[model samples]
Target: MTEIPKAADADSVTEPASASTLLARYLHRQRETILDGQIAAGAHDDPDAVADMVVAARRARGALAAHRKTARTQPEVHRLIEELRWFGITVGSAHELRTQAAWLLAAADLLRPRYVRGPVRARISGYFADRTRPAWIAGRELLASPRFPAMVEDLMAEERLLRSTVVPGIDDVDNTAVLEALLERVRSRMRAVESARGEDTRDAAMHGLRKAIRRTRYYLESVDDVAPARNAQACQGLAAVQDLLGGHQDAAVAKHHLMQIAREAENAGESTFTYGLLLQREIDRAAQYSAALPSAYWQALRGARVMADVHLGSAAE
Candidate 1:
């Protein structure tokens, strides 16, 4: 059995390494994570395996994003990034629905017995289960697809290539510079959120900001060996921001689903009273997350600055 490495072990680097070397190590770790996930997912219908594979793909993609120049210069590596993106989306869709369903189910559980009227819980459960089934089937089909094996092979090939050879000017790729660029994008996304004119636009901007924050956090994690304490702090702060935004997004999605079910229930002449109550709770939850975004963003900004202050060696632009 190939056990997945611990987080600390994956990021620890005792000796100095080139920028290329650091990235290679990071990719290797991600590959191992994906392989471990595949094993676990096969033996058990583990959602955690899906989550692990998704996170690993995102981290590997983020690392390549951080090293923009290298990714641009290496056509094969660029292709790998695209494939990883597709893999993450395809492999994780079913899991995402299940996650939302689980949270919504718990929220429904919190409703008072008197308010829970007329098969509302059953409807909600059934609705999500119905939606999840097709996605789950598709995901399983994808695993058995040729594309899945191709992605695995690509990852292996890239890792070996990275380890054996450093691309031209890859040594000049500065961790600080890459992180700065990522943080700057986050800042820009925050500004977009602020300047968003309508509800839909604002929602999109907020989602974009959440993605930027997550990418920044993953990039920092890739370079954790350079300055473990600072990187950890930075990643922790960004995670807070990402998670807060994630909560809002989840509530939003849950509300959307709830509304759809409520409409269907109305057509069927069922009481939509419970759905109204549930919607209110999700609304309040989303509002709380929105209100907390500012402080979280500030904390993340501070941590990123501290982490970027370290001299992690740089590749020339």
Candidate 2:
């Protein structure tokens, strides 16, 4: 399981003097987190370290996106956002390969001995190990590249820019407006998911929804200083939606890999019956998560509504 970072101590730092300051602090903290993960990952093959780094990169990237309008005139800020995204995806690929293999293997293990046949476990392990080795190499190469250091520098520069400038809407004492805008994006994604008519389109839509949920959750954490309790509550609600969608994604990816493995087995004159069974299992797992999505999405939407209410209530008093 991926390790979640503990929330920072709210009392340890002074309340942000301005919205810009809050954003700046959030960016700085994420940078620190990424650096810490980088150091740990460099020291050893720690999956949790890679996960933390990817998550921190996502949070920093999402924060920039949440207030993107404020930096419309600054191309450098846009570059920073893109770099963070690139960094995250590149580093995350290795972690994904390993986790997906582990998930599928664990599922296969649950099958009775009679159902298992033809070196299924060994094939799965060897296939993933073959791909995972290259992925880890690429990830390590990225970390060592000058581009990585440049990205970190860009994060620092963006933080300084935010701290020095007044960003109008994003610089206000209350940032509920930004949160509302992000929630609207989430709703739009949900609508897209609902309207998707094809399997591929629906999967794409669900993936988009997952990204939106993560961005919203990270944004809420960024401004937790504003209303820690309400924001934390909202984050938890969004986590449900995010986690379910994540499972859906895992199943989808596993099914794809199983298909590839089955093709290889068929080419090698081995029966693909086991692979077919695993593929159907993944299909069923994805369906179950899909069936549960409506309730999870509702929980997220309700949490966002309640958070907005609390923000407005505080402003009124």
Candidate 3:
């Protein structure tokens, strides 16, 4: 079992500040990180740098979405959020390709001595290496595009605006409502997962579950100071579940890529045995992840229930 953080004594109470203040600070910090990531990516052609940029951008986007309700009435805030969405999509495409390429290459290297032999290892590595270039090219093109710099400038302007403007709903210093809202989001996502679980095409469903778990974890972390210690514990549980599902999704994607490679290898009269073996490994791994999902889901569900109890108890008080 994952160890959740122990809750502080209920007697020791700290009144959290207004959500607007917290959100402004968060946006400032995240914007700096995003800018730093972009600068670093521009300075180097390293895939790891690009990956870091993607991760930072994603974090910023998540933070934006988490507090979006408070700022929905502000056109500037809405515009910034929309821009972040497009930025995420652009970087996410490149990141996915690069990630898949890296995974395939690593898989080949790891299995070379045990399963793959001779020219097959080289072929597999080369195929993945070739695939990585296009992704890098795409990423570079996006980075160099005029809109990239414009977005950065726009974000800075919006951050200034956010600092000046007071979000209407977030003026209430009491964060009980915020925590309640986050709990509701968790429940909604959990319900979606339950409905999607019964569907035949579960890949997409599992992905959605993984995303929900991630968002829940992020939300918990953001309001950690305001929420009870149990929220932190719930975050730990959700993190564990997210990792399991994320690995499963990665395997599924790798298997799909391997299948395409296998067909290409066959068409070129090259040995497809290595691709088949790799594909089988991915399939087996995905199955193992699937088998483990029930336990993880139950753990997360329990955490959610506890959180709901906490929220309701606070309301009663």
Clashes of each: 5, 0, 0
Flag the better candidate by lDDT, 2 or 3. Answer: 2
Writing each residue's lDDT as its tens digit, candidate 2 over 1-317 gives 12223334232355445667777788888887888888788778755468987988999998778775654656787788889989988898889999989998998899888888788988899889998888888888888888888788778776776777776557653566777788899999999999999767888899999999888888777777657887888899998899999999998899889999888888888878888889999989888998999998998889888887876776687
Model 2 TM-score on a 0 to 1 scale? 0.90
Name the lDDT of candidate 2: 0.82
Per lDDT, the best of the predicted structures is 2
lDDT of each: 0.79, 0.82, 0.66
Runs off by more than 4 Å, candidate 3: 1-16, 67-78, 92-95, 110-118, 168-200, 304-317
Residue clash pairs of candidate 2 = none
What is the Cα-based lDDT of residue 150 in candidate 2? 78
Clashes of 1: 5
> Comparing 1 and 2 by TM-score, which wins?
2
- Write one digit per residue (lDDT tens) for candidate 3, span 30-92: 566666666667677654565655655555556556654554766666676677767766655
TM-score of each: 0.89, 0.90, 0.77
Q: Kindly report the root-mean-square deviation of model 1 from the true structure over all alpha carbons.
A: 3.7
- Displacement of the residue 133 alpha carbon in candidate 2, Å: 0.9
